[model samples]
Target: MQMYNPEVLGVSLRHIQNRQERRVCEVMTAELADDEDFCGCTLCIEDVYACAMSRLRAHYLHRVSIVLKRPPPNDLEIREEVCAAIEVVRLRPNHASVT
Candidate 1:
């Protein structure tokens, strides 16, 4: 009897997310890093990402047969999502004030 190993096959399920979504989140996080009121710790940053992503419509790219995927458009919606994410982090920060 041989044991089946999925890792050896080099195949796994993954969430195909919009690259722009990450880009926007990263940019926002960096922009807010200097704000004294904003906590830029790892957990809070992750919270921001989660909150923002939840509010925006996600674009997924998967499947090997799929052709080239277009870049996500930068629009007002992206700005709104980043703003909302910032607000969420501000209101519910997981770290203590450095001051």
Candidate 2:
């Protein structure tokens, strides 16, 4: 016989995003904002984020205490990925004319 767990029904679990990854994405997006050549549309930003996320390892901490205990490193690896993604977006932006 197995006991039923009632807590599972009322629990609203949320995935805590890594602050460092957010920061990296923010910085890259801000940098791209200054770029007149590249489009700063919502889809484009999401594209950039997707690209960077694919290359960067996610640091999901289950608890807020754990997140607060340590600070994330300034990762150059993520920066490089964002840089490459920027180039890709620049070369083939979604806003390009359908010629």
Candidate 3:
């Protein structure tokens, strides 16, 4: 039995790294835990650069990977999430809720 649970949402990142995802998850969870939350989108530079160097173009394989140059961002209000998804992601209504 769960009582008083906040809504859980998904945001796509480039790649799921141990160190980086930990930070991103922590920050995002905290932000969403609050009331009156909407949505967020995350763009990764490392993912862009990685595919840029690879044989594949940024749009083909269809997935995004993540690298953490800085600490996770706090309280991102995402109206739209647009990035290079090479691997695969389930694009849904929530992803478009922002912009």
Model 2 backbone overlap count = 0
Better of 1 and 3 by TM-score: 1
In terms of lDDT, model 3 sits at 0.32
TM-score of each: 0.59, 0.64, 0.24
- Model 1 pairs whose backbones collide: none
Expressed as tens digits, the lDDT of each residue in 1-99 for candidate 3 is: 455433346554333333323333344345335524233334332332233234221221224544445543232311111122222122332244453
**TM-score comparison, 2 vs 3, better candidate:** 2
Residue runs of model 3 more than 4 Å from their true location after superposition: 1-18, 39-99
- Residue 21 of model 2, lDDT score: 68
For model 1, the run of ten residues with the poorest summed lDDT: 5-14
Give the Å shift of residue 68 in candidate 1. 13
Error of 3 at 5 (Å): 33
Give Cα distance to truth, residue 27, candidate 2, Å: 1.8
Candidate 2 accuracy as lDDT: 0.68
> TM-score: which is higher, 1 or 2?
2
Compared to the true structure, candidate 1 yields what TM-score? 0.59
lDDT for each of the candidates?
0.70, 0.68, 0.32
